[model samples]
Target: MTLYLHLGAHKTATTLLQNVLKHNEAALEERGLARIKIQPRHLFWHLYRDGDRDAFKKRRRTLARKLQQYYKSWPNAVLSSETMFGTSDLHRVNCLYPRADTALRVLAQLTSGMNRKVIFYVRRQDNFIESSFINRLQTLATSLHLDHAQLLSDTTWCSFEHYLSSFTPSQLSWLHLIKRMEAHFGAENLIIRPFESIHRGNAAYAESFLAPMCATHDLELAPQVYENRSFSAKALEEFIRLAPKQGFANLRSLRLHLQDKYPNTSYPRPMLLSPEQRQEILQTLATENSILFEQYFSDVDRTDISYQPVGS
Candidate 1:
């Protein structure tokens, strides 16, 4: 059996894609694909964070055997997780995917001696950082309450301005991340796409992601399912203003309350970056993006890789 893993870069409609894939599980099964919905936290999370080589090796072998069983039953076994490359917290180190190499190496070891492929979608740097920062705040608010001191000291509570300034343009390069993935998985085994391809329309975006599952040209998929909608700009503004004053549960409730009151259909997404900032980011990454196109996505539209604003 061939293993298909979706290694998310985050803020790239990963949830939506997962939902769509799940919705069409029966169809995929008929087409020789099975969605393997294992909780990554139990396997990949421990492997990525733990330094004990003996324990890591033990878990890797256990997981590999589990995969082997799935392969015996199905021709295609699939796993999808956004955290496979590490969390947005890695940005605290002032780099996009600082631990990605280590994560990829772990993955390479796990799927060793098997036919494995990885799907990764990458957004433009400025949009990715801004959306990732907002998503990180939402994620953290649901987990732990921060006192005034923790709020001040915690990287998660920092303003978008500080977060954006934390990394140099080179540090956020998708090219650098892709090279690491290619090093581990081989360029031929990776399926890479621009996150902005959703701009072609949702149906097109769904098709691009589902392409790897196609055993033939006529594989059918469910209509696109939208998931994990972003909080409105007003909702996020209120969240940041009141998060420290509230408990974690209260913060989550307040966020949901605010989201209901000021949905994205009425309010815009958080436009933290100005037009100038966006252009600067696009210009800075132009060379690397060009090389990315030439090397991996020569058939994709160059215009699709251009700067698309966060909520646009």
Candidate 2:
């Protein structure tokens, strides 16, 4: 038995991956893999309920029962949730997965006695940060009660630099994540995939990536459906400009408000940058993420993906 955990660091085609897994659950099972749907609400309920001592004891018992059921239900499982990567508190993480070295380790323990593999997909920081800003706003609106415009202006609201600070330059960088995982779990146990290759509407990309991990199962390729929901650079800038004027106290409030008012907002679309802006962003990214552009991604293939605006 083997358990594969896909921890998304946000905006890395997580929804697409989850959708595909859900659609192919039956087929996956034939190959000895099960898709474990750990409801987000359940995870949150456990987290919050455990925060209170009395509630913690009760929930712990309940959670143990749930875990037993889950273990019995699936030998080889695929569990995914992006929130697993959001927190910076190691203690909180430890409380969730006590014996693991890192969050990845905790995942490994969940599937102990079973072969385990971790898969994480990351985008270029320059591109990721820009999308992250809007994502923060969306999160704020959905989770908190703050004004989006106000939150944008609040220095405390959302800052790309501050968010990125959670992980080391290497940890946040895809190349670094790949190298680190390779070192920790051996290349065979870790898989590093580029978001672009998958986005190219190529089924071969999916096959090539999943083949080794799932050789036991005869899987079928499904048509790829690109959501194409990210916001363009201009729209992102417009939102940024609108954010400060609205006066949000924090990111949570902004997201809550947005969710209340416009529940259908999607992730920002990838922005297309002008040549000058592209050059500027590339130069800035070079300062910390030089290796991402120079080594992780080949220059010949760089033109295929969207670019971020400079100085925004």
Candidate 3:
């Protein structure tokens, strides 16, 4: 069976894509495909976090058996998860997805001998970093299941400037992540998409993400249901100030409450970086972006990937 593994650089509409696949399971099955859902924690811990080789071997074998069962039902399947790359907590100012290579290596071992194709969505480095910072803050506030010592660390909740200050703009390179992916999953097997292309409030946006993974543009997709909307700027500031004071359960509940109260659609996204900084981020990566486009996206419409700041 051919496995389409969607390794998300999060904040790239990954959750919405996952939901659409689940909603359209019947449609996919009719097309000789299926969406195989796995708990994020399983991959995060067993594959990415754990260093126990013997334990990981046993776990990998167990997961392989589970996947074989899925393949018995459907000849082609997609396994989608951002955690397949690494956890949000791994993000630091100086390093982006520091454990990405390790995680990909572990995943490569798990899916050995299978016809595996990797599906990835690349976002602009500036926007990607800002969004990831907001996501980390959200996780810190709501992830009560994590150990308090780790979860409550000051660095985890540090200001966006502090986070960005840790790494030079030149260090923010998609090439590093893409190279790691190619090393493990062959360059020919990668289906990379620019996140900006179909992200312009398109109702059928999920189709763009899904069709590539399923290897069919002729899919009959259900209506896209938006999920995991970003918190508005005002809401984010208020949430941050209040988050440190609340207990975990309360903070989690508050986050849910605020999601409905101040969805990104209703207000501007949090602007952690000034326009100057945003430009610096873009200028710093211009050559890198050009190389990325020239190498991987020669056939596609290169104009759509300006990595322009939203609402600019």
**How does candidate 2 fare on TM-score?**
0.61
lDDT tens readout by residue for model 3, 1-312: 788888887887787777778777887888878888676665446644446777767767777787777766777888888875555543444455677776688678777788888988888887887887777777764442345345455754557887777678787788777887899999998887777766455445666666654554555454546555777887787787777777766776777677678888787888888888988888877877777877776364376557533333
TM-score per candidate? 0.87, 0.61, 0.86
Tens-digit lDDT track for model 1 on 41-89? 6455675555667876777777777777877788888888888666765
Model 2 / residue 16 / CA error / Å: 0.9
> Please, what is the whole-model Cα lDDT of each candidate in the order they appear?
0.73, 0.52, 0.72
Could you say which candidate leads in lDDT?
1
What is the descending lDDT order?
1, 3, 2
- Which segments of candidate 1 are over 4 A away from where they belong? 47-58, 142-149, 152-158, 215-225, 307-312
lDDT of 2 by residue, 194-302 (tens): 5766655545545654564466245555545534344444444445555565544553454444444433335344443335544654565454354444444545445
Candidate 3 overall lDDT versus native: 0.72
Of 1 and 2, the candidate ahead on lDDT is 1
Mark the regions of model 3 whose C-alpha exceeds 4 Å error after superposition.
46-55, 71-73, 89-94, 142-158, 200-204, 213-224, 308-312
